[model samples]
Target: MKSELQVFQDYIRGRELRRTPERERILQEVFEIHGHFDVDGLYLQLRQKGVKVSKASIYRALPLFIDCGLVREVDFSEGHWHYEHIYGHSHHNHLRCLGCGDIREFENPALDHLEEQLAREYGYHIKGHHLQVEGYCPGCRQAGAFPAESNFLAKDSNDQ
Candidate 1:
């Protein structure tokens, strides 16, 4: 398997874009992170490492990374987007805690079967899919982490 930097270099060359040290540094930092992260968190990490990368550079590089299949965007309904590097990883889904903002990664063979069934039934070419299941985690529920007002279902349900 090619290293992230090599893959990125190939991608940059293929696109006729210049490969800069800043982009390489950004890629290094991105892969160093093991979990979900937003731009602000990424910027802070880079700064702490004494890398002089700007947020604008990060913003511009993100799309390129996504295009090259090195990264993917994940939304936890946190208003801003979070990103995770997907290179060298198998597909998985997320279970997120609405109360404490915790995330757990899981894989199910049933989803693969369902995807295949759907493709066969609909006659559609399937590429990929993302799933994020959200609810209060066990600890959050036990601790009563967030108030009812934070629960959109409680606020919006007619049954309430």
Candidate 2:
């Protein structure tokens, strides 16, 4: 298996695009992240780590990163792109905290069987799926707003 940087470098070379150290550094930073991240958050993280890459450079390299299968874009209708590593990870679902914009990854093998059954029933071949369950985290949920008896609907910030 080729290293992600090597794969990306080869892709750029094959496309006749020049490779730069800045882009490679951006890829290095991105590949290191094990959690979901957006362009703004990644830019700040790199800067805080004393890396000198600009936000524009990170944004530009993201497409190439996605193209080379090093990253994937996840959307939850948040009006921006969130990315995570896909090169060496298995399929997973997301639990997104709507209040803090936090994301947690989880996987259930049973989903594969369920997906297969659904595919067969629909007479379609399953390629892939991205599932995001959005809700307020415990910290974001207002105390006493949602009683234990009716906890299915937790009062989020907007309900206040």
Candidate 3:
């Protein structure tokens, strides 16, 4: 398998975009994060490391990374989007806890079968899919973490 830097460099060259140290630094920081992250948090992380990268540069590079299939955007119903590097990772879905805003990754062959069936039935070519099952986790349910009305309305800062 090709390294992330090699894949990114190939993509940049194909698109005729310059390969700058700043963009490479941003890419390194992005892949270093194991979990979900937003642009503002990424900016802070790079700044703390004394990397002189502007958030604007990060903003510009993100679309390129996504286009190259090196990164993907995930939404947890928060106001903003979070990103994760998908290179060298297997496909999976998310199980989100509404009460505590915790996210769990899960994989199942059944989902893959369903996608195949749907594609054949509809005669549509499927690229990929995102499935997020939302509910209270065991700990949250046992602790009664939700409000009286509904837990679905709960939104937290840690909703990744």
Candidate 4:
């Protein structure tokens, strides 16, 4: 399989934009991270690498990359958005912690089966799905670190 960077390079080559150095740097950064990152984070990293591109350039390139099916936007439920590369990899859901903002990736065959069953029962053909589960992590729960009480949903009422 072609790497994400190769895929992105081919995409830009076919687009109106040629393979400029700035575009190459942006695509490289996106491929290196391979995880959810806000534009600011990506900009800082690019700057550190001596890429003098402006934040606006990074922002503009991101949408174009997404439109070209190079990257994907992921919302992990922390009121913050992130992006990840989508180089034709297998699909998986995310498990995010509301306490420490940690994101864990998981693939559950049982959940996939359940979704298929539900879709069939509803007389609908399953096309795609995105599942994100947010909760306190094990350490957070053990420490009784609830998420601002407003969003706490611990089964143990006395957890707090």
Q: For residue 93, what is the lDDT in candidate 2?
A: 95
1 against 4, candidate with superior lDDT: 1
**Alpha-carbon RMSD, candidate 2:** 5.0
Model 2 C-alpha lDDT per residue in residues 1-160, reported as the tens digit of each score: 8898889889999999999999998888888887888999999989999988878888889998988888999996789988998987889998988777677889988888889999999998998787889776787665423224355456444556
Which scores greater on TM-score, model 2 or model 3?
Answer: 3
Candidate 2 TM-score, true structure as reference: 0.75
Instruction: Tell me the tens digit of each residue's lDDT in model 4 across 19-81.
Output: 777877888888888677888899999889888999888887888788777787898765766
Each model's C-alpha lDDT?
Answer: 0.93, 0.84, 0.91, 0.81
Task: Rank candidates, lDDT, best first.
Answer: 1, 3, 2, 4
TM-score of 4: 0.78
How does each model score on TM-score? 0.90, 0.75, 0.90, 0.78
Between candidates 3 and 4, the lDDT winner: 3
Q: Candidate 3: lDDT over CA atoms? A: 0.91
Better of 2 and 4 by lDDT: 2
Clashes of each: 0, 0, 0, 0
Best by lDDT: 1
Deviation in Å, model 2, residue 96 alpha carbon: 1.9
Which ranges of candidate 2 are over 4 A from the true structure?
A: 138-160
Expressed as tens digits, the lDDT of each residue in 60-143 for candidate 1 is 999999999999999989999999999999999999998888999999999999999999999989998999998778898789
Between which residue pairs do clashes occur in model 3?
A: none
Candidate 4, residue 152: the lDDT equals 52
